[model samples]
Target chain A: MDVKTRKITGQVIFVLLALYLDGLMKWAFLNNMNTGEVMLIPQLMLMVLVMLSMRISDRRQLITYGIVFGLIYDSYYFGMIGLYTVLLPLAMVGVDHYKFLFVKANMGYEISIYFLALTFMQSGIYILERLLQQTKVDTMDFITFTLGPTLLWNMIVFFILYIPLANLSDWLVKYRRDK
Target chain B: MQKFFSNKKLIILMLIIIVTFGLLAVSVNIKDKKSTPPVIQQVGNDTVSIVGGIFAYPTNAVKNASSEFSDLYNTYTENRRLKSKIGELAQNQAKLKVVQEENKKLKDELKLNATLTDYTFVNASVLSRSPSSWQSYLTINRGQTSGLKKNMPVMSGKGLIGRIIEVNKISSKVELISTDNELNDKFASEIQSDNKNVTGIVSKYDSDSGDLVMENVTSTKDVKKGQKVITSGLGGLTPRGLYIGKVSAIKKDNYGMTNSVYITPAAELRNFTVVTVIKSSVSGEE
Candidate 1:
């Protein structure tokens, strides 16, 4: 394959791996089985998406990644289409829109961006599911139990995986020297 | 009218809102009412699950190894406890087999093909679980091709775990019993107490204490702390005698009018890499 094709392929594979890791991590570790009250959902896919959104300057590509992966995620995992399919694109676009403020991406900015994206995506999902009558968890309970723990856990994971993830995402989005 | 329609962003925003609600409403309706999702969605899910198996297998292998390691740690005590129960277990097994044979003969004499309690199971390996907060679903490898149907109760090695909520071509989603969703978790359950069978619905999950909330019990007076709870088969989709859990505690509603039995679920709800989907022999009101 050509260099551009190779880069795009690498990016797709990385995102796919992240997506799979999200589910595996939940199944293997963060299932909240022992402590049923506090739920910690791994947002590795969202973290990778946020990183890519910041790096990939093309708005249309970011939105496409959002909607497509969102659909796959919703279909395969959530069993609902609209939750991720719409909100993911919105999150990506939001990241892409605000990323211009940062002349150069740094750990601080990337981490905060991921944090915001995670919060927005998760809260959006909660609200939509609530309205759809998919979940009966009250607001306070949701925030304290689900949102609080998920954010903390994912943030810690993001911090730990930041260097490698950021570098990998940078390489995936960077243009070829030959081009 | 032309000028009003010329605002591209406004039109796009309106379209997006309409599409969002429209998609959400339609998908939810289809999931609740239909046996399977749309063809496109089924194909998408099946394809994704096919690829997901590659990652799931290795992870599940590692999970199994870890669980085995933990089991090894407790083997000495567990072996002693198990040895004490072995004689009783063998006796119960022989008695159960004889009773099952008798029940089969009686059913044959009556020409009863199937009943609410008659069920067969298909084992499916764990693929992956949903990472969402509300929709606590587990994707298993088996699907409609394996006679899996929507709302069929699933079990882990220990006991009842959940039910199949969505069935695709070659994959399906099991909504666990512990989910906060009201419509999906209700199971017709009963407790076997001395002299009587008190029936109730396992309708809610208490996440705080990790107990299932069984409501509408005839009498909480007879429900002891250690009484075993099982499915009553009142609901046609689920078969009778599926072990749910033990009665942990009984609590009254705020009004003191009704009682809810808190059950400690039998299934660990984790550490299992495979699940069994119970397909009832008798077709109910579905």
Candidate 2:
């Protein structure tokens, strides 16, 4: 395989790793199971996707990744189509659109951008699920129990893992001339 | 007309909106209908779950080890408490075996192959739990090939935990009893009261208090705290006498209309790696 193809494969593997981690972390650590009212959903895949979108420059590529991963995520995890399948790509494109305004990516900018993206994606999911009558959780209860804790937990995770994750995504997206 | 269609961006945006609603509506309809999802979706889920098992097994191993460590801390006191019950348990086991054999003979004589009380179980390991808030699904390794079907009650070691919501070729999703979804959470349950039974529907889950609300109860007068609740088999797919929980508290709804009995489910709802899916002998109407 050529270097370009190899890099793309590596990027896909990285994203997939993060995707599995989302399920694993929820299964292992954040398992609520008859205990707490606060539901914290770990969005590790979104964190990885945001990092990749910030690095990869192609708009078409971003949308494609979004739709493909979104489909898998919906089919396997949610068991319902169109929630992540639509929202994930929209979030990726949103990040890609405004990301150029920054001269250079840093912890603060990336963190804030991720924060907005997470908020947007989560709220979009909540609204869609609510409208579809899949969930009856009221807005206040949703904001309090589900949204707030999830954001805080995922943001703290993003903050801690930002350096290693950012470097890895950079390595995956960077062009090598030797190939 | 040609000039009106010239805006490519607007057309794309319109298409996206149409597609989004279309997909959501169709999927939601499919879910409500209880039909198998499209072929591509089933294949995709099975493939994903097959790969997911590799990751889930190791994580579940670690989880089991850690929980065992915690169990070790309380073993001494637990052992002392369990020693007293051992004698009673042995007697009960003997009696149960005799009764089971007699019942089987009676059933054969009566030409009854299966009844509401009869069921078989399939064991499956936990693959992954959905990260969504309201869905509350746990993917398991067993699926259609295992004779599993949707709406089968699943249990951990302790008691009933949930029911199968979706099934693929090799993987299925279990929707927990604690799910906030109104349509899928209700269980036809009954409480063993003095000399009689108090039947009700275990409908709502109170997340804040971590109690299951059993409504439509016949009488709260006979009901008491600590009474055992189990499936009544009124709904047919679920077998009778599947342990649900113990009656924790009884309260009146708003305006003091109907009584709702709060139950503390026996299943820990966590910690267990393997789950048993109970397939009832008598198939009911879908």
Candidate 3:
């Protein structure tokens, strides 16, 4: 009914929509479908954008979003449950751990922390899998190809997502004041 | 003294809870059917098309913001072509659906035809590859159930991504042809030339260019550049005709019949959608 609520709803819709796009990109890129591969922004970039837009209230919601993201992946051609359970909470933990220091320092710090956490959450599991003889990767080559850009991509996604979310946050503040 | 007693009691309580929950968790994990690893991480790559039965269906699961930008173009000439020519439209649409069905049928045919060939391709998706120099590994969507075996070869359009060295029910890890720090030495000593069909044990995966070091030739084989290197049918473990790489450069020993050769793949290792898995044919020794 109020502008603040409407703003919050819009933000949620944007994040969800971005997530859906990332899921589609995963399908398009990974599955090699015939879906005309013209990406305005790559999925990882979009992911970072969405993450930047995100300002969840509590840990439970963060976990819920993570599960939803993971399940969307699983239902498709992939089924990596280990990634979701391990990576999602770790992302949240890293974010929470760093949020306090970064928030005071600058948005850049906050963003970097998000990037590092997501990167670690993803590639860390990969590293573990390879090290424990759980994977068949030729350790160095795997490092060269799989870790770096994935980290940067997530960071980019967060960066892009932050812009619109900032405007929405401003609006929410305005509405709260007016009320 | 009283506080110490309470702390001791608390520790005992925590330990009991941990053990109880740990046992429960283990039992639950054991009970779940999905938790088990799928077989065929190596041998069943021939079944990708068969196994792709459900996954190949078309889906409009997620629409994106960019659609609004493109919707205007679709509404005009795109629709007019199909709309004005109704008779042609009907025929073409019917034909198009038929063609699609046919295409899927052909894919199934490939799957069937696959088993007949020594080269069994396990079509798996690239899960992750980053530009970071250190993070080298690709997670594939297909795992054990796909007939992927440990040491089963994987390649993109360019050439060898690696072998399916580790496998779970739904995913597999490929050890790319140019991997460093191999944990196992036994399988490490073999490199089948993509060019000459000469079989030699590996000197090592040269990281500088990401090629293999092939050994065991006399002082007379003409191992030259642009020559194709592939698995030798002699070893009979991996199917032949798999591209190891194009021989980029070579340095002759002068006294012996060996050269330090550089080979490059056809596919960019960091990015690719699909890849084939090469397996030795069940029929054996042609």
Candidate 4:
């Protein structure tokens, strides 16, 4: 195939890897079933999606990726439909909208954007689940136990994985720049 | 109308919000009300799970190897403790064999076909556990194709772990017993004592201390710590004599109106990668 098609395929595979890694990481390491109140949800897929959105300039492409992958994510992992299906596209669009403010996608800007996106998506989920009566956790307990630990853990992971992920996403989007 | 139609971004934003809540509400209801999800969803889940098994198997292997290393660390003490019980276990096995034979003969004479304790199991390796906080579900490889059904009790190496909440064509989801959800976590259980059995619903999970809280108990007077707890089979779907846990402590609710028996679950909940889905021989009311 052509270079552009190959590059797009690489991007999809990269995001898919991140998606699987989210569930596997939770199952392997963060499986705190019995002992602790603190919960850490791995959002590696969001991290990859944000990185790709910053690089790929097309708005429609971003939304499409968001919806398709989000549907798969929700169906396979969450066993529910709309949480990721809606929030993911919104988060991607939000990233794409603000991306032009930065001249170059550096670590600082990308990490901050990811942090914002993660916060928005997670809080959106909590609010929606609360409204649906799916979860009864009060606001204070959710903030302290689930949200706090999740942010800290994911931030550390983003920091550790920043260099490779940034370089990979840059390579995946470089074909458009060459054209 | 013209002014409102001119703002495309606003229209899209409103559409997204409306669709979001609409999809969430409908799917949640379907999940609660339906025995199986829609066929298209089942196909999607089965495809994802099949691919997931490729990744899950290797991770499970690594997990098993690591756990084996830890097991080696405790081998000496475990061996010593187990050695003393070997003789007793052998004698119990012989006695149990004779009793089972006599019981089978008696049942045949009485024309009884199946009992609550009769169950068959399908073993499934867990593919992944949901990262969500409230939904503590594990996706397993076996599903409707394996004759698995919803609400069937799941067990690990030690004891009961959870129940099947959703079944797809080739994969299913097991909702763990530790989930605090009000609708799905209840298991009818009874404390086994020498004289009298105290029956109760193993309903709530106390996340603070990681203990299962049993409520609606008939009497706490006969309940005692260190007693065994098992499924009483009073409820439909689950079979009798499935090991639940040991009675850890008894406490009163905040209102102090009733007593709750707390059980320390026998299943490790974190360590195992495979689960057994028990199919009761005598199906209860649908």
Q: Number of the top candidate by lDDT?
A: 4
Clashing pairs in 4: none
- Report clashes for each candidate as comma-separated counts: 0, 0, 43, 0
* Candidate 2 displacement at residue A62 in angstroms: 0.8
If ranked by TM-score, best first, what sequence of candidates would result? 4, 2, 1, 3
Candidate 4 residue lDDT tens string, B158-260: 9999999899999999999989898888999999977899999999988888999999998899888999999999878999999999999999989999999
Task: Give lDDT: candidate 3, residue B250.
Answer: 59
DockQ of 4: 0.80
Model 4 has an lDDT value of 0.92
lDDT of 3 by residue, B190-280 (tens): 2343344344544445555555555454322566667666655444345656656566665565685566555555555533456677666
TM-score of chain A of each: 0.96, 0.97, 0.62, 0.97
DockQ of each: 0.77, 0.81, 0.08, 0.80
lDDT of 3 by residue, A1-179 (tens): 77757765665555444544444444344322112221122344224322432444456655665555443332221223344344555466456545655345345765665556656655655664454343465646455544554555556656765666555544433444475
Give the Å error, residue B133, model 3.
6.8
Give residue A81's error in model 4 in angstroms. 0.5
In candidate 4, how many Å is residue A65 off? 0.4
Specify the CAPRI tier of model 2: high
lDDT of 1 by residue, B1-286 (tens): 8997999989988988888889899999999989999999999999999999999999999999999999999999999999999999999999999999999999999999998788899999999999988788999999989989899999999999999999999999999988877677799999989879999999988777989999999987777999999999996689999999998898999998999999999999988999999988877888
Candidate 4 lDDT at B140 equals 96
Report the lDDT of model 3 for residue B147.
70
Of the two candidates 3 and 4, the one with more favorable lDDT, higher being better, is 4
Q: DockQ: which candidate is best?
A: 2
